[model samples]
Target chain A: MSHAIETIDLKKNYGSHAAIRGLSITVEPGTVFGLIGPNGAGKTTTLRMLLDVIRPSSGVARVLGETPQAGGPALRRRIGFVPGELRLEGRIRGRALLRHYAEISGQVAPGAVDDLADRLGVDLNREVRKLSKGNKQKLGLIQAFMHRPELLVLDEPTSGLDPLVQREFLTMVREARANGQTILLSSHVLSEIQQTADQVAVLSDGLIVAEGDVAALRLGRIRRVRASFTGIAAAALRQELDHLPTLRDIDIDVTGTEPVRLTATIDGDIDPLVKLLARHSVLDLAVEEPDLEESVLQLYGSSANGRNGEVRHG
Target chain B: MVRVLPVFRRSLGDSWRSLIGWSVGVAAALLLYLPLFPSIGGDGEMQQIIESMPPELVKTLGYEQIASGPGYTQGTFFGLIGFLLLVIAATAWGSAAIAGAEESGQLELTLAHGVSRSQYALESALAVLVKLLWLGLLAAALILALNEPSELDVTVLNVLGASKALVGLAFVSASLALLVGAATGRRSLATAAGAGIAVLGYVFNAIANQVADADWLRALSPYSWAYHEMPLSDGPDWAGLALLWGLGAVFAAAATLLLRRRDIIG
Candidate 1:
């Protein structure tokens, strides 16, 4: 498949401070690509470069097989973008704002804006200043999707959106992907991207720490497993848990309890722990993915010394 | 060829209320000041009161021709109050065209919709020009309607000429603001550039009229180019008109070039 977006060693520097450093990546056409990063990790900067709103200090970026800056308005016409910081003119009603954008793009159908507004539950008659944050976000989303462009570049698309509206947004993204449109979704929230992105790139401190298929990346990380024993003593379970090679940071709570509970984090392999559990009369067992916040923190802490080289391919 | 019509249309829609407000203000100022000219010009006592004042103050205020209908109207309204009103309107429009939009994050959104930077800047300048023209025409119509009743003795042609000079003078300040706003994307800097041009021009003209050695300063002041010959009585100064329009065009062209090269910050 041809690439939808490609950047070769893209760099942006604000005087002496480097915002994005030697970044290179390729996104396949018709795939939902997630740019996952923490705040100030240069996600918005990268998106702005692709849109030609800001020029790169070095390297190059191509959208839809053309240089962003050289392609000019024609290139921009094929891409829909939602900026992270969305500020609308307070005097304009929401409908008028969408109409203006629609007229400029010249691609949105007559009723597309109204249809999207209905789906998103946004009232188009209200002035922008009167709309709440969530409502304003809905307006932004409607404009981005109304044009039905070849590519959509969204930066923190779900910020300030309620969970229900966020779900609707994800569904819209899925529909766009199904329609053969490529999407570049940038977000600090892991789950937001994890739900819709087929491929993910994790950026930390201006460097890509890990990148691959979402499922594969999840599998590579550690998981927390908690188990409670009914017919066994806590001491007996602890002794068995020590023998398991896969378990780490193992903790046991045996304080005057009829049921013994043990919690441990495991990585690499879980078969040894499974066999140990099978030997005990386990009453309840829970295996949970690590919290996204904690996982990001751990990733940053661990990669401080040995930054993972950019994972370019899936 | 990028289409900037959508941007232009939206700008007009956004500013129509302010445009009407400015038009009403100019009309009121004209009605209030033009009718008073007959009373002041016909009364010999008022002329003597003016003659008794300091010669320097009369020269500075451009009141030498206060005894005639044309002179009285020009001194009271066109040269003083009307000039202030038009410049205020133009300055606000010019500063808001680029820098205000950028600060509000609307420029980024508009450009994302396939509008080229140069096209956006050019269209914004055109919108400001159109608004300025609207105010000028309204002022001219009101002046012409009240000409006979107020006994100002100024013809319709002369009223239009005076309006042209006012619009041309305001254009210089507006264009300066557009240039600064487009180049720097800072509203305060744009406002300062526009207000500075107007204030400095007025000060330079006033000082030139008061001091013999500084008479050459009038050549550098846009205010002089606007009102030096009293457009209503002497007809429009074609040379001054050329200079004002030429400066506006130059600043607008510079703004487009600079906007194309600079980065847009939200």
Candidate 2:
């Protein structure tokens, strides 16, 4: 199959409110595709429809080159999934739970589960219900990753994980992609997707606002940069930096007429801004990574929604 | 080659404790009420006491014939206490299998694997049937054990017949519960629907016994279909048993279909 996943005019409605409005995207096989959006942006809805956990109101989704309903259980055998809102409750120990899951999802080599558990450092001997949230998340990861399915669809996979474990998870993702597996993962955190995804689709308000290569989207991402200078007046600093493209909302403050402090959001590369500041005696600089919603708004706020490297599917 | 019905296996694993508890409960109810037949059974003063009550009340209670051996067994265990115990156990198992798992997110996770919707529901149906059968067989064995000791003269064939009828009746209730639970994904709603079927059936049968105009209700009530012939004393009602079994099958089928249509809510 040329595309591991493809959706055309995908739509879902919760009563009168349309949760997903005509979503369309295509992911090449053997690549990491990140679906990034804030909560309620319909990212979960789109991913769930692909997994056939939720049916679409209209349009079609083809995964692994088969319509989900036509593929049925046979198609799902080639997939591994982790729900966004995970709830696992049982009196049985985690090891038994994992074993049971493996038995249901086709075959797994002996010790496959144990190996994953060891890597995740999750104690599978404890009862599933009694384990902490992070531990339960680890167990979820092990189950999804153990089978080594052709397509892995994970939603908010690192919500409850510590940074160390999250790093380990990204490593696993990298390794999975290297093995020619297609990964479709959803996240509200920009950096998570930036670190693992080869291609990214930014979703907002039930629409794809931007889609492109990770580096392309990175350049399009808006960051609020604050800098202080001692040699230039606030007006002169604003005029000089303003000439450099990709800057907006320039706010400057001069308290005691000593150092000029300027705060503004830059849409594209910060390299030009840095070179311009090198000529002045720079004091302090703080650049902030906007949260997902802010970043999405900033993307939509610019021409990047179309001509700015946004990939259009065929 | 396949997973050996792995979904069914795991469901049973999760259900063993509750199934055992229910079996013990049905057995205890039978053991408690049957042995007393010796002291308070037969057509002597006990019949007078039953007669002294309001005619509607005696008929409603199914105490019209408590003197004969088979009559005493039917009146004490099969038609009354044991049926209640068995139906309660069935409904709980039925509702918990699908609706309970749905609420806890276990259903979504298991279902997202290679298990098809129909396959999962069918396996759940199998689990429900197997668990209910455990209680049914245990109830039959307990009553048979007390048959001679309690002066119950029920024939072995008739005892087994009545056990089958009781199980069939409970199966209808449990399947109804499973159907509603699968459709709604609400545990409380499904449990109520399951228990409602049995409760309404029992109450309708009682009302039909008193009100002559309500005779047609007996045909609609699974409870009446099960005990109308008093299978313990008069032999089994094969037609009625068939209807009960048939209705349970329809409900189970409908449940599987409904599960196939809805989304798996986490």
Q: How do the predictions measure up, each by TM-score? A: 0.91, 0.93
Tens-digit lDDT track of model 2 for B98-199: 898888888888878888889988998888888878777887788788878888887888988998998899899889989999899998998899889888
Query: What C-alpha RMSD does candidate 2 show over the true interface residues after superposing them?
Result: 1.8
How would you encode candidate 1's per-residue C-alpha lDDT over A1-314 as one tens digit per residue? Answer: 65899999898988898888877888999999999877877899899999888899999898899988898988888888999898875678999888888777748877888889988899999998899888888898988889899999999999999899899899999999999999999998787888999998877666676788897774335779998888887787788778877678898886948688888889757777888789878889998777654565564556533354534344
State each model's CA lDDT, in order: 0.85, 0.85
**Over the stretch A69-106, how does candidate 2's per-residue lDDT look in tens digits?**
88888888889888888888888899889888887775
Cα lDDT tens digits for candidate 1, B1-266: 23448778889989999998998899899888888876767777669978999999998888888887788878877788888888888889899999989988988888877889988998999999999998889988888888888887888888888888889889888999999999899999998898889889888999998998998998999999888878899888888888888998999999999999987888
True contacts kept of each: 0.75, 0.83
Which DockQ value does candidate 2 get? Answer: 0.64
**Deviation from native of the Cα of residue B52 in model 2, angstroms:** 2.8
**What clash pairs does model 2 have?**
B42-B67
**Candidate 2 segments exceeding 4 Å error:** A218-220, A226-244, A253-262, A272-285, A301-314
